[model samples]
Target: MLINLWYVAEWSKTVKDKPVKAKVLGQNLVLFRDLEGNVKCTADVCLHRGGSLSNGWVNKKRDCVVCPYHGWEYNGEGKCTKIPSEGDDFKVPPRFKVDAYPVEERYGMIWVFMGDLDEKDRYPIPPLPEYDDPNFRGLETEFTWQAEASRVVENGIDIAHASFVHPVFGYPDTAEDNYIESIEKHEEWAVSHNVMYPPQLKGGFLGWRKLIRKDKQPTVVHPGWYLNGMTVKIQIDLRKDWKIVMFDANTPVDEHTTRTFAWQFRSFMKSPLFDKGSLKRLSTILHEDAQIVEASQPYYLPETLANEVSVKSDKFMSTFRMARRRCIEELGWQIDLDKRDSYNGKKVLTIPSPGRKEALAEGRGWVFETMPLVAPVKTPTEKKDFEKQVDELTVDQLNSKDNVIG
Candidate 1:
């Protein structure tokens, strides 16, 4: 998993009066709301005796989370405020703190920056204009997939799969008619517009749903991906004034697990009575996707496309891969999974936070070691060579054999 990106740790409603446990990018985290009702996140491990802060409780003042094992009170900023054993007169050292992350509550989710980058350098969170728009009624749900996050994200943006997987989306006979209309790319995100001839909507009260769209109707779809939160957004224009938008934030619970926080919004269905069918259809789509993604070979996404064959239809997904790979190799944001796994049970390693970065700059030491990152390309010549290699890889992808079997 890549570091230095914003990730949805939990639903905002989930973290309230008590500390809640969350895991992202393989590291455990503790989330709680302070006295001011602001959400705060920090490494779950306490410096004293390796106790779990999440297993503890918010103190009486509601300003700090008190460790159950030793009564060490850590405030919202992760500074140790009180040590019961040390008595009132004792002052905790400046180094007595845990890694505290920057937290923002948006779109009903708790977004935490899982790296040490300062505020100015971090990419802004993905936008969801439909969240507060009155024209749309949104339903929120979450799903957990037993697969790597990158694989799950690719599946979400792959428009071609709807023909074979989701019956409500398209039909195999009309698959040839589906084509990408245009693609707009950015440094951290991209959006692709596609036109598809799909079958009619399946479910509705009685036979009224047939009026929405007939069989083989031309549909317009916009699929987008954002690096922040590992998000995927698909907007379907059912008609001029009718639309359905799905925004999903895929969080890497670990190397092999992904948790998706999803929101489905429909412009036509503004009443609560229609929500049941909308949610049921969304659930069906997710299950269909999980069946294929979980069973795919090569558990993690390939670092290169050498082992995979990609046709023109997969170019959008390739953009995501290329951007992620840049972060891994050029920016050195990828965690060294092998090194981390080696110290699995014996050592405690935390993702570096803004607090950790500040402490280190001042020559203060941390109790736990920081997670290891893959080495980045360091020299100017090496960067030029890497870019040339990427260009070659992209060129090689265009020569894919259509008849090749998976």
Candidate 2:
């Protein structure tokens, strides 16, 4: 069940008339934009003796990609347009075609579908709340590292690791007990949440100064396909001045290696803090995460093992893992527990979006619809009873097979 969906390959603006090579779901692809302004993605390997299409050049006039080897040309639809050695009257072999994936451009990123053509539109890339918001300012950066894609994604959701792994950006003392606030499912996308954090600083010199204050706002976590890679979106609201920070990350290249494209968005783009100093600070913070993430790679663990005791504030990690597992399973890629443990398996699929219904229909049903709403079950009596029951349960019971698991 290789569910087909779009994946963000690169910033739409990044691909010009020049060809760019990318990999999606383990397949090498060549992308380019023609004079007609349409973006095209095709197998980088030409069917004609397996030559690399990326090694060729783009013919803007004919809106085609020309293979460097022997001068074979392919149109945007991947149809053979010309063969240098053959006359125009010569019939082209059907096998002469190159593989083409469906592509869509949005939020400055070019998205390509890696699954079945019939289901292309069934799963749309997750929407970016900050993309069109005038109040938000966006900054982009690229990071190349020797690490698996799963490790990077897990790091993004692991709030606890932030304290030690990222001393500067991670505020352990101010860490809030985040719970899965809610999950919203759409025809093309899904969204989940961790506990909300207040804007007021609870610790640190900044906290003492009270320079920046925000309401207790929930952190939105969204993981889906964009371009030719996987993307994770985290949104936090700084209530005052309509300030917001949205972290948009994508893995254009995934293997034992990964390339991440990230952007920080805020309403105030002109402030000096955000201009030069803030950008540097943000880079440092990302670098911190990258270092730890890369280091943590060799010792990656499964989400099932991450179910150890969690404080009230540790709710986000659990909720995020559940949502991630759901997304992965929906995409028809199984979670190989053994491989995940070994750190050398397909831990995630390449589809930009997973068809919610199709994914849920495979097994466990859609938790979003079947799972009881627990956010509102916070009455004093209920809370006490729930905590008491969990406390009273034996270690075995707490870790029992019957317990609900992701």
User: How high is the CA lDDT of each candidate model?
Assistant: 0.88, 0.55
What are the candidates' C-alpha RMSDs? 3.5, 10.1
Best-fitting candidate, measured by TM-score?
1
**Native-referenced Cα lDDT, model 1:** 0.88
As a whole number from 0 to 100, the lDDT of residue 366 in candidate 1 is 83
Which stretches of candidate 1 lie above 4 Å from their native place?
A: 378-406
> Across residues 53-153, which tens digit of lDDT does each residue of candidate 1 receive?
99999999998888989999999889999999999999999889999999999999999999999999999999999999999999999999999999998
Please name the candidate that would achieve the greatest lDDT relative to the true structure.
1
Q: How accurate is candidate 2 locally (lDDT)?
A: 0.55
- Worst lDDT run of 10 residues, candidate 1, spans 386-395
TM-score for predicted model 2 compared with the true structure? 0.70
